[model samples]
Target: AYEYTLKAEKVCEEGTQKQIPLYDHYFFSILICAEVFKLDSSFHDQAKKIAYKNLKNLKKVQTQMPKNFRSRYLLAKAVIKMNFSPNLKKEISFDFLSVIGVANEDNYLHIEGIACEIYGRFLKDKGIHLDGAHYLKRALGLYERWGANFKVQAIANEISNIQNDDFNKEININSFIEISESLSNERDLEVIFKNILETAITFSNSLKGAIFRRDHNQYFVISNVNNDISHYPQSIIDYAYNSNQIVRIDSIFDLEDFSKDKYFTNNQVRSLLALPLVANGEVESVLYLENSKVDKVFTADKTRILEIISTQMALSIKNAYLFKNLEKLVSERTEELEKKTHQLQISSGEKQTLIRVLCHDLANLLMSSRISFKRLNKKLKELELSDPDITRYLKKIDSSFTNQSHVIDNVRHLELAKEKGFQITLTTVDFLKTLTNSIDTFEQQISTKKINIVINENLNDIEVLSDELCLGVNILNNLISNAIKFTFEGGKISFGLQDDDQEYYYIYIKDSGIGMKDQMVRNMFQDNIHTSTRGTNSEPGSGFGLSIIKSYVNKMNGDISVTSKHKDDFPEESGTTFILKLKKAV
Candidate 1:
């Protein structure tokens, strides 16, 4: 891809198109070379130089594209700086944080995955395997969703190796996760600043604190006390802000050189520190802290943690700004739509509009929560602790978020049904392949219940006419879930495929578990009838899955039926079987 793009660039430079817009191609070339640099150490030197030149070219024409592309550009910058430009180590964290924040905000999974993977590798090379593993695992999840199976396998292998080490550092996982979630959930800038100051004061044992944000060439002060800049010494703040470093003083009066300085001479302060918050290669803010009575309040370990907090603050601030801008854009778009479609907005259209708005907002909220989880995972890794219990808890948390995502998908599909009336495009889908993937979606649940899945025969060559999304996510997925829900531990769920006639094929799923009454099974797909029953484990349902499945099946010109005998009536062979008949694609 890189070579072909480079050839195209040369051809365009030779006057075929005269000033062709190849920035996107250049951006991709940078990414390809950057990945090569990451995977192969031998290509580091050449890859870095090539990627760096492309980055410079990208920067020149960045304004011609949408602001979202800035995240990708920053990612490329982080890759080059992390692997090749060692002198810019101080700026590496900021670059990665900004890239991640923007990528998460924009829902750019691939970009986020690449950033996390490279960041993980960077941490691993620094001997922080625990944190590296956390990032690699995050990258693994993102890649899996992006359908990059090869990359997912590679990252999983990397995470396994990292976790093999015996790391048992004690950490307060709940507290850190809470802090990260609090910061990530809030988009109000003032609230975030207050939280940052309060957390910094409490953790660092400071009497009072203030934050000064750099704007243009001036600094604006925000403090727990009065907004007076004179309340705190400006000299240390200036030094930290100008130099982009932390300044810690044990005692102001102890330094002989400071005796002439008016603020140090006049004040009774004992300990003071000024730390700069840098993001995207610039100083964003300065956090000034003081202890009037105590000496040496800011210790090394405290400072180290505070530095990490500063990085978090920078990321939160940038993300908040991004969200603010996006909200403005959304408001503008909504206003335009309202004006243009005012006459056409009927009752159904109004409901659809509301659903669209809610879906968009809910998606943003879910993304924010996921970002907080990633941050917490990163912090846990930073602690160098490798506890199985913590990992298990994290997985549970991740699973819950994934469930929320599925709910969002179902809601979106509901909106689609409302608008299109259960419309579906029938395509020739491989019957066995689709069924296998659908079953794999419930792999965790299946494994948990120790259920055996049996396929009657190989139907790899068979194809059926159906909508892929409807068949995979909506129909087959829901049916499989229902089977797993009612199926007892160590039960069996079997699948069989057959051609009942020249025009149609039959697919049957049978589960050997508790079955419903015949009358209830007959009315299962009725819209007004509530046929949902608690599973063996008392699992709850929305009572709408069957009706939706029936609608989708009818839309695809298919038929579905169920047969079952109650466990009380037939003790030896009580089970439920669902038979679906669809057209056999030629």
Candidate 2:
């Protein structure tokens, strides 16, 4: 048919009557060839190329033709273009509509029928079965009207094929969805391979199946069901793997030359199928299925379904391999962490014991020294030899002892707070009493600095949820002592209590003193920073006082914050205010 069309086109080009009617025979022949060849996969490509080349040539002289000829020419052009680029729906639709418009105006039934048939096929290819069937029926009616019995019968067959295809597609889609869901969460490679082989066997209605995985050039059995690795046809498997295509044999006799081979000649082995699972453009594995009972079990439809399953199986196998590796890495890391944690526990226990011994021994020695110093002061007073310098030296000695005691106590308390399983016992406590006791503890330092302590009148017998030892000794004592140490001579330290009708009450401790810098305030409560500065009288301190305060406050479920301005930053109003928000006793 293609050769005849070419011969007719050549004659039309050569003769003096190279006009519409002469070219009609060539185009009509070419159109029929395109339509017939498009139904067969073997000739589909050649048909498109031939039709496209001739239509492109016809396009140059198409405008000179009459309406009927131009419309027929357009219908043939659209059909060929659709074969070349089936996905170009918009361009194809516009071309079909243009042909139909001219056909309607000129009453060209044949041209319209052909346009509707091509449009219906395009829609059917895209899975629009209902709409495609509508157009197919329309074309069938138009062909009947134009007295083309063959085209009418062809359109009727197309509609029947669409109905069958739609049903098969629906079943295929549901099966794929179920298979995908079943394999989505499978992480074990052995389990994944087993499931894939079993599913392939069931779906293909095969008696036995095996999945062979490829590593470089080697193929090994990963999973098998009712079959051994040696039982599968190696030649079929090799062909599918090497060619990256599905190989199916309905019967041993179909192998032709290999039909007499031992594997194929066996009476028990009738049908064989080998499918290559390709991932990332590489053949990763091959699935082999055999049906001993049925000769032609692996049909074309079954082969297509198995091919789609092969794609999903490839991804599942890859993911399972990755998950296995990730699980191994996590196990190794967890074991290493456990070893390091054990070593750290031993080291920490040894350190804690050493600290406790030192604190205990040093506290007893300091107590003995204090007793001896008091006895000596008494003896000197009894002798009535009160030299002015002697009194001053004794005072300085006492101050040194006091500073050493404070350092030792701060270290001991900090160690206790950090001890494992240590917990603060919160209970209802008198807030006013705690404040007063803390103030009394720092009375000697306040007197030496001559700082006036102004207790707020609103500080009544208010109760708060707190640990008494943490609140009084660790928190309040450190804050009051700091106020006295930093205040200038005769400076004022004020305490204010506030109730804002909330779940917690606020306590404000403000002092008029040489306040802190921005950097000092920022790092004051951080355990890693050294924020301690010498007092107005050069009194010393352990830098962890605020750190201990913060830790205990957090344990008691309270909050603490500080606001300070250095004397350099604010000359007149330079002081630090520490605010504590403690829960009110219910």
lDDT of each: 0.73, 0.71
- TM match of model 1 to true structure: 0.39
- Worst lDDT 10-window in candidate 2: 166-175
Which of the numbered candidates is closest to the native, going by highest TM-score?
1
Residue-level lDDT of model 1, residues 1-586, one tens digit each, is: 6457668667665764424356666667787886677678887777677787888877766556536567778887887777677557569978988888889888989989989988888877776555666677678779989999999778766654553444322124444444444454455677777877876665555657999986786667888776777766777677788889888887765556345556776778877788888765677789898866556667666676677667656655665665666566556755554555446533556545755775787688669757756875786688676777678657866865775687577666775664567556789998888888788767778988999999887465778898876787778888999999999999999998745688988889899989999888878987544466788777655455787787778778898989997899998899999999988897
Per-candidate clashes, comma-separated: 1, 0
Return the lDDT, model 1, position 495: 91
TM-scores of the models, in the given order?
0.39, 0.34
| Residue 364 in model 1: lDDT | 85
Q: Model 2, range 175-234, lDDT digits (tens) per residue?
A: 433343334334456676777776666555555788887677666785554335556666
lDDT of 2 at 130: 46
Q: After superposition, how far is residue 519 of candidate 1 from its true place, in Å?
A: 2.9
